[model samples]
Target: MKAARGSVVSKKGVPWGTIISVVAVVALAAVVVTYYLVQSAPKRALASWAPTADNPDPSLNIPGIVTGQYQASVHILPTERVAYDHSPPYGGPHDGYWAACNGVVYPVAVRTENMVHSLEHGAVWIAYNPDQVSGDALNTLKSKVEGKPYTMMSPYPGLDSAVSLQSWGHQLKVGSATDERIDQFITALRTNQNTYPEVGASCDALGAGAFDPDNPPPFDPTPPGPDAKPMDYQGSAGTQQDTGMPSSAPTS
Candidate 1:
């Protein structure tokens, strides 16, 4: 039907394809932004809580954190153990050989004495009660320690809490692996110059005969015998070289 000279042509349906494409792009952009925020939020929070002269021990601000005044440079032999005042002790006399705490996660319970030495070297030890933590809960704790220097995690049988974090003279026990205080404790104490005894100590194992991370010494759950080393017992002079002490004076 040939109409008059100029008939108006009307365009009917909406541009559905174009609209859908725009919506998809917008959704993808939103997801990317959300992920960035989620990943960086914790780091930002930790930076704010970093230790400063005014806040010498920022871990003190963390709720339920237990602080102690254990003397440094105290080391015991591998065959000896200390009658630690606290369960999964935060500090005190420790084994002469420090555990391999450079982001190592032990599948079995490690000797507390060796682990405590790692703490003195400014490493944060994450001890979880195997009976209480497993599966996702266990993995969640591992995520905080694995591949993160100055950090290590191990199963501690008979642990009073589901999770316990130890760094030098500090300790924090939480009921679950998802506790926010876990990161806070790590941020404040791991390698904090004022808190730990050794400032720039190495978290690596000495070697095969020393503290082997793969086949480390088994944790003895038995109560420390009467002959166990006392808290005030000064360490042997032979092991002092491994304390990471600078040629100058040592810090508390």
Candidate 2:
């Protein structure tokens, strides 16, 4: 069993936790929103990494879901000269992902400061489709390459969003992969059947995360409830910063 997030949460604003609701988790098409909570921890704050606001590569069509605004823009980034500054991947036993771009193979999922820094942590891979992306957007993206390399990441609205992911872990809200591996991953976290070691993905699953479980809940893999609302949220970046995009590497 993983240690409770509260135990690691620092008195400072840096919290390694903020129990995520089932809706948000499903919405993100991820193992759980526990990732946010984990980053809140002080020890975990500078743990990952953030990149230079610039890089020079445009082939990868990216999108920055400006949470403050409902709009998304196209951006670009150069990945060849990457670096890791802080901690490595958080969750234990998480799978590593891989992808192929123009006949090139790259590790899509692996926990590291470089992953988060490049905003390449959760990039998705979309089978190249020209119509999915307009010509104007593509040309504009290329033009912005060197001056603001990472700027091309944010694709304009209506590009099916997940159009570019040459580098990160792509967070999905809903659709397609839901019934597949996503559901299974959530199920494991819901019940004690699985554990994250660092992040707590509880849904009162183990009796509200056990204040201090001298004797924790039994290991049961069933989900709490189909439509469970973990809790209310006050902050939601209306637009997804890194989402529903395709990528060359597997998302961890």
Candidate 3:
């Protein structure tokens, strides 16, 4: 059989077929060579002077900006990941916001505004904020709605059983940030929350013993307005996120 013009030889005298086989072999060789080149290429390393475990931020670089709407560059995921997805805390990852605030490292949760910054370097955790019923107990409520009708998806339009709690925590809280800002340019994203035993929201003791000692609770931490850019800090992993307590109310 006459092979195509590019073919110079044939396997068992099958000329055109030999041309196809030769092309296939060449393609495979190219792929192998490309793979090796990629594997052998010099890696791009961070600056030699870059921070290390011993001195994390030598020049004081701000790291891990998670909650301003951009997805976390780093995240706290379940230790054991499944086949294709992360096994996040709570019934699902979304629950952490309404109920998952506890999963957030206390320092991160308190940052409330600069969430991503915390997720970047600090330890991540999960815990649920148990809802309390105050004011009135109405009867006509069939199943009693059982605890705040709590679902991760509440307070948002997009999610189904999947909701972004960390998103809500930032969005709903006073002086919170808008989701679009962080999310706009992000390429990858995930939200995380864990649970912890219930802690008292308020205390009666005054002075150093009070543990906040305010009513309806000074428990909520609202971030400074989006425009209130965060300042840099030089401290331990935990202190990096410290905006301190949100002033019970920011002074005008």
Cα lDDT tens digits, model 2, 44-71, are 4322222223422211122231111111
- In candidate 1, which residue pairs get closer than 3 Å at backbone N, Cα or C atoms, i.e. clash? none
- Provide the lowest-lDDT 10-residue window in model 3: 88-97
Superposed by TM-score, candidate 1 places the C-alpha of residue 244 at a distance from the truth, in angstroms, of: 9.5
Those runs of model 2 whose alpha carbons end farther than 4 Å from true positions after fitting are 1-117, 120-129, 147-252
Clashes of each: 0, 50, 22
Model 2: weakest 10-residue lDDT segment is 65-74
Ranking the candidates on TM-score from highest down gives 1, 3, 2
Query: What is the per-residue lDDT of model 3 for residues 1-252, given as tens digits with 9 covering 90 to 100?
Result: 355643644433657778999999999999999998787652212233233466432222213222322222111111111110111111111101122222212211221222222232221222122132112311211111223112111122212222123321122111112222222111111221211111221111222321211221122223234433222211112121122232232221
Instruction: State each model's CA lDDT, in order.
Output: 0.86, 0.25, 0.24
Best by TM-score: 1
Give candidate 3 misplaced runs (Cα > 4 Å). 1-15, 25-121, 124-252
Comparison by lDDT, 1 against 2, better one: 1
What TM value does model 2 have? 0.18
Per-residue alpha-carbon lDDT of candidate 1 for residues 32-144, written as tens digits (9 for 90 to 100)? 99999999988987886789988988888898988898887777667888888999899898877899998999999999999998988899999999999999999999899
The TM-score values for the models, in the order shown, are: 0.82, 0.18, 0.20
**Which is the leading candidate under lDDT?**
1
